[model samples]
Every structure is written in C-alpha cells, then in structure tokens.
Target: MDRPALGDLEAFLAIVSHRSFRKAADELGLSPSSLSHMMRALEKRMGVRLINRTTRSVAPTEAGERLAARLGPALSGLDQALETVDAWRGGPSGTLRINTNEHAARRLLKEIVPTFLSRYPDMALDLVSDGRFIDIVADGFDAGIRLRESVPQDMIAVPFGGTTRFLAIASPSYLERRGVPKVPDDLLGHDCIRLRLPSGKLYRWEFEKHGEEVAIDVPGALMLDHIGLMAEAAAGGLGIAYVHELVAAPFLASGALVAVLSDWCPEIDGLCLFYPGHRHVPAGLKAFIELLREHDRRGKLG
Candidate 1:
C-alpha cells in the first residue's frame, strides 16, 4: 500500500476528532470545500473509503478508525518532539487550551489574561467556558479550572485561587419584604434564587458555622445556571441568591445586593488548575502554571 501524506493524515485525524468537516477545516486554516477536496484526494491516493458523511454528521470507516487509533499517539509524540525544540529555544511557544466555568472566566482569568498574553506573545491561550465536569484529555484541553473538591483524584492539581466563601445576597427591598434569613434554614421561608447545575439538578446551598455544616434545599422563585445572572436576578429583587463573594463584590459595593447569612458562609477550597497526571506536561502548560502561581503569590503578598 502507498504511504498516506502526512497532511492528509492530520486532516483526517482532525475531522475524526471533531466529527465535523467545518471544524476540522477551520482548525487547519482551510475552507470546508478545500478540506473536502483534500479528503477526496487522500481517499484516491489510499484507494479506500475513510469517512462516511451525512447532512448532519461525519464518522470514520472501520479502516479509518483503526488507522486513527494508531496514528493518534504517533502524531502526538511527533508534536511533543517538535515542541521540545521550541521549549529549548523560545522558553514556551504554543497554544494552551483550558476548560473552565463562567465564574473563573470572569472573576479569575479576566484580570490576568491580558497581562499574560502581552508578556508571552508567542503563547496562544484559548479559554473555553463550560459548566460541566469534563475529561480534559479526551476533549483536547490542556487543563481545566474547577473547584478543588470537584477535581479528579488521579489528576495533578494546582491551586488557582485562595480559599473563598459563598455569600447569600439580595436587594434591600427583597430582604425587607421577604425578611432576612437569620440562619441557613430561614431560607426555606424566604423567596430564594436557586442555582441549577449543568447536570440539571438544583444546587444545594452549603453553609458552615461553629464546625457544623448545613446544606439547604430551599424553594426559589427563580433558578439560573450562571452566577452572574443569579447576582443580577437578586439585584433586580427576584430573591436571595447564593453567589461567590468574588462575584458579589461589585453588586454589594453598589448597594444593589446585600450579603446575608455571612456567619453561615464557609471559607472553602477555591479553584484548581488540573490536568491529566499521566501525560507529559507541555512547555506551554508549564509557563501558564508559573504565571498562575506568580499571580497567586502576588495576591497573597498584596
């Protein structure tokens, strides 16, 4: 059998990984039609049908799947080997992809990303906002930001932020009308603003005081997925909202939202930058980690 072109193999792998011709084409800096032409040419050269395409989806043929399984690791190793030179000469120069929640995107990364990009001009960072727990390796992400408790045990983890507390907040008018909760259970009697997790279940508000912890499943007039939206709802007097103190800072300062049940709010382990433990850490990832740790250290000092 004739050897397939390296470019052809790369395009095929990208298409198979994404299951979309358009996405693979975009990644390769080619038009969809161009990618289609390349695939046809590749198929002609190999004399085999490598992919099956429908209007809605694309999938690899059995031969293509087997080929991809073998090619994936080999190509990955080649990429790493190539990057080693860049690391030796350039210090760190590659794209870094991360999956994180909106909260971290807004509260944590927002402040640092610009500086990071300016300082490391060769480093390309892609921050993908996702609320669900994802396997970073499977999804082609370099790392992910999640709360410490939620990070997988087998993964290598680094602290992204200091211990943070949740705050129950509401507008002055809402608190006055609904009566402020003196305790965690008092939320049951008030019009609460609840959070809905990505798994489609309501979030239980957690509180800790005097070494005792409480989880409250309070009824709410509104349920939201984004923390920013929840803060907005509470500011609009929808109900009492459970929010991170970092997210509630501006609203509380503006007097649009007032913190309640502060005594019950627990200072919990904050976000972690986690990645698969088994793989070799990319130089790009090491630079990112160093920046994160520097930011964390500066925050502690300041």
Candidate 2:
C-alpha cells in the first residue's frame, strides 16, 4: 500500500482531534468539502475506513483510533524536531496556542499580550477563552491557563499574576434594600446571583475564615455562567454576585459594586499557565513563560 501525503495525515489528525470537519477545516485553512474529499482519498489509498461520519458528528473508527494514537506521538516528535531549527532563527517564531478561561484571557490581554507580541514580532499568540476544563494535548493546544486549583496534577503549572480572591459583591442600593449579609449563612435570606458552571451545575458559594470553611447554596432567581456578566448583573442590582476580584474591580472603583463577604473570601492561589510535562516545550511557549514570570515579578514588586 502507498503512504498518504504528510498534509493528508495532518488533516486526518486535525479532524480526529476536533471531531468536526468544519472545525478542522478552519484550523487547516481548507474548506470542509476539500477536507472531506481529502479524507476519502486518504482512506482509499490506505484501503481502510478510517472515520465514521454522520450528519451530526464525526468520529474515528477502531482502525482510525489506533492510527491516530500512533500518529499523534509521531507527529509530535516531528514537530519537536522541526522546532529545534527555530533556535538558529535567534528568536521564537511560531504560534503559541493557549486554552484559557475568560478571566485569565482578559488579564493576559491587559498586562502581558501587548508586550509579548511587541517583543516577539514573528510569533503569534492564539488565546482561546473557554470556561470548561479540557485536555490541552488532545485539543492540540500548546498550553492552558487556569486557576492554580484547577490545574491538573500531572501537568507542570507556572503560577502567574498574583494571588487572587473571589468577592461577593452587590450594588449599594440592593444591599441596602435587601440588607447586607454579615456571614455566609445570612446569604440565605438575601437575593444572590448564582454562578452556573460550565458543567451545567450551580457553583456553591465557597467561603473560609479562621480555617473554617463554608459552602453556601445561596438563594437566587438568576444564574449566569460568565463572571463578568455576573458582576454586571450585581451592579445592576440583580442580586449578590460572587466573582473574581479582578472581574469586580472596575465596578468596585466606580462604586457600582461593594464587597460584602470580604472576610470570608480570602485570597487563594492565582491563575497558572499549565502544560503537559511529557512533551518538549515549544520555544515560543518557553519564551512566553519567561515573560509571564518577569511580569509577575514586576507586579509583585510594584
């Protein structure tokens, strides 16, 4: 049997990784029809049915799965080998894809992205904001940014920014109307803006003081998924919103929101950039890490 072209193999891997021809096409800069034709051609050449295609979804067949498993590592090795040549280029020049949550994405854009891009003009940063936790390696991402507590144990985590806290905030008018909650339990009587996690479950409001931890299933009519939206809703007097301090900062400064449970909401670990330890770190990613550390150090000093 003849071997498939390198590009065809890469396209197959991309399709398997995304499980969507359209998404793979977007990533590979090819049309979905073209990718489908290419895959069909690849299958014919290999004399195997590699993918199971349906109207709603696409998945690899058993043979395709085995092929993908082996091909994934081999492609990674090839990528690393090619990346070795980047050292001679005198600087990192490839794109670094980071899957991150919205809060971290905003922070990076505000403090780090501009400098990073300016310093490495040849490099590109692909920052994808997603609330749900995902396998970065399987998703073909170079790294991920999430809170330290959320980082996978197997991955190496580099903490950045600084320690951050969640604040239960409400508009002054709403607090005055509904009365302030002096303690976490007091939230039972007050209207609360609940957070809906990516897993389609409500996030129990967590608090700690003097080593005593409390989790509250606070009463609320409204539930929002995004932290920034929660803050805005609180500012609009919808109810109390528990959100990262960074998300609530502008509202706090403008006096649109006030922290109510400051004592209970102590600072925890900050955001971290995490990646798989088994693979060779890309030069662009290594450079970004260095820049991130430098920025964090300066932030701490300032």
Candidate 3:
C-alpha cells in the first residue's frame, strides 16, 4: 500500500481538531475549497470516509476516530523529538507563545521580561492578551499567565509575581458627587463602572473580607469590556470601578482616584505561569520558567 502524504495527514488532523472546514483552512493558511479537496483525496487514497460533515458541524468517523487516536500520540512524539533536537542547539531559541491577561502582561514586562529577553536574544516572544481562560496545549501556546485561582489543578503552576490586591476606586469628583462606599453593601447604592466579559456578559464585582467572600451586582451607568478602559472611565469620573490595585496605583498616587472599601480588599495569589503536565515542555518554555524563578528569587518581580 502507498503511504499517505504528510500534508494529507496534517490536513486530516487539523479538520478533526478544529471540527470545521473553515477553521481548519484558516489555521492551515489554505482556502476552504482547497482543504476540502485535500480531505477528499486523503479519504479516497485510504478507501474510507474519515469525516462526517453536516451544515452545522463536522466530526470524525469511526475509522477517523481510530486514526486520530493513533496519530495523536505519534505526532506528539514527533514534535517532542524535534524540540529535543532543537534544544541541543545550545542557547534557548524558538518562538515562545504566551497567553495572558493585559494586567499580567504589564506586570511581567515591568520586571521579568526585559532581562529575560536581553539574556536570550535568540528566542522570540509572542504575548497574547485575552480575558478568557484558554487551554495552552489545545491552543498551541507555550504557557499561560493567570491568577492562581483560575489555573487548573493538573498544570504545573509557578508563581510569576507576588501577591496582588483588588481595589474599588473612583475619581475624586465622582466620589464627591456620588459619595464613597464604606462597605461592600454600600456599593449597591453607587454608580459603578461595569466590565463586560468576552462572552457578552457583565462581570460581577467580587469582594472578600474577614474570610467572607461576596459577589456584588452593582448598578452602572456605563459598561466597558476592557479593564484598562474601565480604569480610564473611573479616572474620568464616570463611576466607581473594580480593578487591580497595581493598575490603579498611579492614579491613586496622583490623587486622580480614591479607594473605597479598603478594609475589605484582600490580597490574593498573583499571576502564575501554567502549562500542560502531560507533554514534554519545549526548551523555550523551560527557559522562561527558569527566568521567572530566578526573578522571584532575586526579588526582581515587582
């Protein structure tokens, strides 16, 4: 029997992983029609249908499922072997893709990234800032930065930065007009700047004090999606905003904003670098982890 082309196998895997011809095509940098043709050719060569397509979705057939199960490990092993070879090239090299929130990215850049980049000039860094949680392995990311609470238990989580606190802040003018909320319950009576999530829903303000946690549904005159935008609005006297203390520090120091319910604010575990435990981590990722650890040890992470 003639062996299938590597392109055909890759196309098949992409289609199965994406579950959509359009998505797979987009990922592979090929037109949808071309991807479809390739899949058809692959199926013909194998003498069996590998995918079941419908108007709304696509899925692997029984034979396709079996092939995927076998192919997944083989492909993973190939990638690992290649990475091991690449690691032996000496200094860390290769693009390191990191998924993180804007706040975490900012914090990391403030102290950790500069020296790391200077030390490993050959390594390229790709930082993607997104609010929603993502699967690093499935999304093809080298690692992800998120709050410790948000990280999954299966992943190895290393503290990337020190503890951080959340603050409820408002412009002095807004507070003078609307009055500051002394307690979490007082937030109900004030106009707050609300955050809209990527899922198109408002984020409820969360608070903790004396070991009691509370989620507050505060009324807002304006709703914004980005945390930076929400901070800007609060600074502009729009309303009270729930934001990370680090992001609000400058404004607080400049007297542009005033903190409310300060006694209730609690310090939580800061950003953590997490990755899948099941796979062999790339040398680039391993190097990054070491940098973070060294930064923490030297008290360089601020």
Candidate 4:
C-alpha cells in the first residue's frame, strides 16, 4: 500500500542488468550481503518475489522482468530530465561512463584524461577498459572508444589521436640469429609473438605495401593477448612481434627493437569516440566531445 523508494527501484534495475548480487553491489558501492537484504526488503514491501536466487545463480522472476521492462525506460526518462536540469546549472556535472579498449585507455590517460578531470572539477569519469566490442547502450556506457574503422555504422563517431599503424618488430639479436624477414612469406620461417583475439581466434598478421595487401599466419611458439606484452617479448629477444607502432615505440627508440618490413605498414584511420545517434547526448559527454575537438583544432594549428 506504500510507494517504493526510487533508490530501491534503481538498485533492483542494477541487479537485473548484471544478474549477480555481487556485481550489482560493486556497482552500487554496497556490500553483497547488504544488497541481498535490500532485495529481500524490496520483495516484502512489494508483496511478491522479484528475484529467483539459488546457490549458483540469481535471476529476475516473471514479475520482476515485467517491472524491469517498464522501469528501464521510465528511469531513463527521469535521468534525462535530471541531466537537463544539471546542464542548466552551467558546466557539466555528473559521471561519464566510457567503454574503451586498452590502447585507447592508455592514450586517454596520457593525453586527455588528466586535462579532462582537471578542467571539469564537478564531473567524474568511469572508464571500463575492455578488449571486446560491446553494445554501449546495453552496457549503460555514455560512449565507447575504438578504431574509427571499428565504430558501428549506426553510431555517431568523433575521431581523435590521429592516424595509427601496426609494425613488425624484432630485437637486433633475434634478427641476427634468424635473419630479418623480407616479406610476409618470410615470417613463416621466424619465431613470432602471435596475438590471440578476444573472440578466441588467432589474429593473422596483416601488412600493406603500396596497393598490395598481405595477411600471414605467422609462425610462433609464444602467443599473447596484449600488444604491450608482445612488444616486451620481442624486445627481450624471444620472438618478433606484430604490434601497434605506439606499443613498439619505446623499444625502437632505445634500440632494443628494430622494425622489419617497415614498408609494409601503412598509416590508417585512428581512434574515435562513438555513441548512439538516437539518444540525447549527456551534458558530460558533450563537454568531453568539445574538449576533443579543441585538441584537434590545436593540433592542426600547431
């Protein structure tokens, strides 16, 4: 007979989205046991079982599903309304959640994040570094950062970080012992640090020269998932590595690694911040985009 608290409803939505009390608790900054008690209280207040919980799993009950289906859009509208009010107060103020790959995260930390946080004292940022592509809207992220080519067709993309390239690199010792690879075919005779994609497929080393494109199933005894790790292994003389130029930069500068097949690597379109075109852009996200554009203008001017 009493109205449920807004916080309680929001907590319920977080639980359903993650399908785990522990994860939802982490998101809400509450202990798992506390979250469990809150859910029990909510269920009692509503006079119905909302969540079906077992020792191994937790899921929403039928009633909970219907509630969530309705609550999702309602809460989103409420959030937008609140954000609209906040935007009128002057500068953007609130958390901006972004999903990005490791490389992009690193770049932001070095080139953008410090400036962003310093410039907007009222704003907070929640950055999730992930290798796999995800649905930003479903994941509740304001935006996502990935290579321009990888941005979804339906999303609006704002490019940054300039052009990037992948390089084939090896330690001088390794090249001296195994002979430098002259072409993509020559990689078959060398020990290489191969990459394992997030989808469980081994990434084929790709190269371009003039208009010719080459993809090689490079031979390797060492397989790594991280570009930095692959570059480190190559620098340690374990094997040749195919990695982003940024990943190999330090080693190359220090003379620990020498680039092979340099002519094959060509600059490509760079990283982009992408978001759903249909949704109203959050004030914090708009501020971030404006900053990115300012940086681009400065880069062009200099």
Q: Which candidate leads in TM-score?
A: 3
Off by over 4 Å in 2: 1-3, 19-23, 47-70, 278-280, 300-302
Predicted candidate 3 versus true structure: per-residue lDDT over 1-302, tens digit per residue: 57899888988887887788887787677999999999988899999999999999899999999998888788778867776765466577878889999888887788668877888788989899976777665566778999999899999898866898889999989988988788899988988899888788888888888899889989988998887888889999988999888788999999998898988888889889999876657778888999898988888775
Candidate 1's displacement at residue 123, Å, is: 2.2
- Candidate 1 structure lDDT: 0.86
lDDT by residue (1-302, candidate 1, tens digit) is 77878998999998998888987887778999999999999988888999999999899999889988988888879878887787457567878889998888875556678767887788899999977888676567889998899999999999867888789999999988878889899988888888899999999988899999899999977888888899999999999999988889999999999999988987888988999876668878887888888988888411
Residue 69 shift from truth in candidate 4, angstroms:
2.8
Candidate 4, after superposition: displacement of residue 63 in Å?
A: 3.4
- TM-score of candidate 1 to 2 decimals: 0.79
Task: Pick the winner on lDDT between candidates 1 and 4.
Answer: 4
lDDT of 4 by residue, 19-136 (tens): 8888788778899999999999999999999999999988999999999999988887887888776646757787999999898898788767888899888899999997888877
lDDT of 2 by residue, 6-90 (tens): 9999999999988999978887889999999999999999999999999999999999999999998898899788878776876
**Model 1: residues >4 Å from true position, as ranges?**
19-26, 29-37, 47-66, 87-89, 108-111, 130-140, 152-155, 197-201, 209-213, 253-256, 277-280, 300-302
- Candidate 3 stretches with Cα past 4 Å from truth are 114-122, 134-139, 152-156
Model 1 error, position 254 (Å): 5.0
Clash count, predicted structure 3: 0
Q: Each model's RMSD to truth, in Å?
A: 3.5, 3.0, 2.5, 3.4
> Each model's TM-score?
0.79, 0.84, 0.88, 0.81
For model 3 the TM-score comes to 0.88
